[model samples]
Target: MGSPAANQCYYPNGRSASTDFPCDPGVDDSPCCGGGLGSTCLTNKLCSGPDGNIVRGSCTSQAWSSSACPLYCLSANTGGTDLISCSNVTRSDTSYCCDHNAFCCDSGVGRFDVVPSKPQTWATWSAAASQFVVVNPLSTAAASSSPSSTLASKTSNAPFLTTTPPGNDTTSGTPQPSQPAQGLTAGAQAGIGVGAAVGALLIAAVVFLLWKMKKNKKLLEGKQRTENTWPAVYPEPPKMELVGATPLRQELDGSYVPTELPAVTDRAELYGHRV
Candidate 1:
């Protein structure tokens, strides 16, 4: 029989008798009690022989308190018998056990069993999940449910989940219209119209400039001709002058004019004289 105080069986030599001894509710099994030679005490049913004094259960040594050890063990086995045994209990009940490897009822969407295959940045995971939910109605519904269910669904479906492209709205997949071709056509037509108008204006300006130049050249030629045609010589008007003085001789000749004495010399001289 075991000691009533320690709840552990011992041999007649006052040493531990069994290697599979159960732990006391509040007593630590490490640093096993001393006894005679060849006698041994085991810790948490995991150690054996005289040297098996260290606590070696599923939990670490620091968690060996009566309050913590059993809870740790129960939680480690939560997906199996432990959780099934505590299934009827509420989450707030101390008897309820939770699994660290599987999605627990209280764990959130990205925690516990939902952890990613490859390590993910917070932004990457959130962006991917958000896009998936936007495109998939079922995923969206699942995500809106309890955190544990959401996490479980996400983990199970991660390989098949698809995400919307960045900058695209997942709710609507409508594409935007392209504008380049239409814009280019309009711009080309406008440029051609403007170029034609400018060419016409330039031609008109050149014609006007040429007309003004020709008119000025003709006027200059007319002025040069008028200057070159001017006369070099001009005739003067006649003037009056006095004759010989025969006034005294003319009074005698008038009285003698009745006689024809001078007719002889005057005929030939007056008719043939060329002097």
Candidate 2:
């Protein structure tokens, strides 16, 4: 008998909230592949803290939109689509995704087709979804390949594929090639990258301008403070010419008119001191 804990839904070893473990959020409450009955993922939130410990909480529709849980929650329209070619879409849950009675389910990184009635178990699902391949959208090689080919190549490399064997073709008895899940196009990825870069640059520029303005304001305030703290000194007024001769001038009719000379005070006396 498999250990009941083995079937329980928890983050796989080394997997955490930081890791990408894409799943169809619609069937979170259903029993995952390899999980025994009663071992449904309903016990814990699919996305949690860094430790990946299973905690009791609702992984609600709001959680999906907010990116608190970054699973590729598909809507009801994806029901009949093949698992390999299904769209890796993140949509708000209207009648699916995180609900108990999910209409559609993709067990792992949008690769495994799971009947919502019989979803992949916790052990297999977490392990498969956690093997995330980081693809550089800006690389020329990636751009050269078709979107389907690029996606197929990445999904084919999952380490868990060996662990959880794929369903074999009944007639050929050969393992079928893993189909590629449709994701964002190279152009879309590039646009997102460019937008992010532009946003960061704008934020940095705003911060720099604010800092510069604050510095200038402080400097101006300091200058004003200095001006207020000190008093100004000016040159003394010009002195009167006390030692010069009194006026004695000739009138227009040639008569000499002498003006009485007033007593002149010494500089020291003028200044209220005896000379």
Candidate 3:
């Protein structure tokens, strides 16, 4: 195919312009087909009355008369509509080209158009609705595409798309240096994991120690105690044996009898005082 005229048509990818995609038998159409910069696009749009009530259908740039405020067209390229064709669009008037949930940052200079506290970003829509809205006073890509060459912005110049990177002030056009988001860094995450593991081990050790201590306590409670202090009990002593007893003998035939023995008397002294 030959090159596309400057403002004629663009291919699915923004790099180059072409009329039709190369033929593919079974693959059918690519997801990147259509929804080009100048293609006819359509989707559900967010419209509201001055009372903040939702209104059906889309509003043209002229609908938002606050020319003092930054106004740019956003294309909601949601769903597979990007794969559909925009060949039917000969002009872009009320249409817009907004990426899914994309935002067009703006500043204000007109009545009731105080600099917005925050950006007016695009919201996602289930239906297909996309067009190039011009917010600046200068002619934008949408200006040539819109029907009557009319702009909604009250200003004389604005960028087609005003997307600012993080850490950069939009109005000042200066890059600021600051700490990044508070999300944990890779090393910090690793440290947290290690700390958690150590904490788990410590908790397990403490639990085991507590269990052992409880067991020891139960054992001590169940043990018996022994003490030596006690009252002593003794049996009565037997009567003193007789100083002198008569001699007796027992026969072997199961009968007890006195033996043929005589009783002896005690001698009192060597002088034969008693017999």
Candidate 4:
């Protein structure tokens, strides 16, 4: 290579800075600005000049923008800084920002967790499985106060000690909302959720397809049944024809002939076939 100084001198944005004393002087330094926005801050733990000079620059904080990563880091999963990696996220101060328990995901930390608190009960149960009664802490006192009355109060001013509200277990320290779910960090959990949704969609699609197929089959069957049960149609009949003839009086000197046979007006009658 010609020189490391030549590459680091020119920034991608057309800005140039030349310094005899490189940030690491004798060491070969890589080019900056290629990483894009917030890229300059990512080079080392502490901030420095464009050419990696230690004394020539001052530290200034810049908020990471959209161009910094593929996805925006959500508020819940974010640390002091907006950026997070799969392994760990380091802050500007060099302190470790995120805990290693869950994967730092694009949206945030994915949680598929199990509740930690154990439930407490004062009720007694029989092995017979038929019955159980909540042990009333005031049952004995009630019997003594008014022997005749079975449902007597413990005393005039004492409140009955029964069930406590959900989450108000006086026995332990305020139940710490179970520290962000134990295992299968953000990445694994997100994958599982996406997979489940896709599976459900596929199942629904299959069911709809099957229903459509059955409907079409029923329609075809109904059409065939109608054709089989229909009656046959008949064609039109032939029309009747008429015939006419002159009378026999014109043939015998215009006189009415009694001996001659009358004019045969009908063909069927001449043949003696008239019905």
Score each candidate by Cα lDDT.
0.30, 0.31, 0.28, 0.30
| RMSD in angstroms between candidate 4 and the native structure over all alpha carbons | 29.9
**On lDDT, who's better, 1 or 3?**
1
* Pairs with steric clashes in candidate 1: 2-9
Per-residue C-alpha lDDT of model 1 across residues 56-82, encoded as one tens digit per residue:
222112222222122222222211112
What TM-score does candidate 1 reach?
0.22
Per-residue lDDT of 110 in model 2? 24
User: Which pairs clash in the backbone of model 4?
Assistant: 23-52, 110-186
TM-score (all chains, Cα) for each model: 0.22, 0.24, 0.25, 0.25
Q: Point out the worst 10-residue segment of candidate 4 by lDDT.
A: 64-73
Choose 1 or 2, whichever is better by TM-score.
2
lDDT of 4 by residue, 1-275 (tens): 22543234322122343321122212233212222111122212112323442111111111211111111112222221122223232211211112232433322333211111111122232334322222322233343333322323322211121111122222232122222223454566778999999999999999999999999999999999998888667667798766556544435466665696787766654446657
After superposition, the stretches of candidate 3 with alpha carbons farther than 4 Å from their true spots are 1-15, 19-201, 217-249, 252-275
Clashing pairs in 2: 25-98, 26-97, 32-120, 32-121, 33-119, 33-120, 33-121
Write one digit per residue (lDDT tens) for candidate 3, span 1-275.
21212123222122332322211111211111122233221111222223332222211111222221122221221112111111123121222222222221111110011111111212221123332232221333324333333334333322222221232222232122222213333455678999999999999999999999999987776653222233355668887976669767676787677787558877686665665
Model 3: residue 264 alpha-carbon error in angstroms: 52
Give residue 21's error in model 4 in angstroms.
37
Runs of candidate 1 with Cα error greater than 4 angstroms are 1-179, 182-188, 232-275
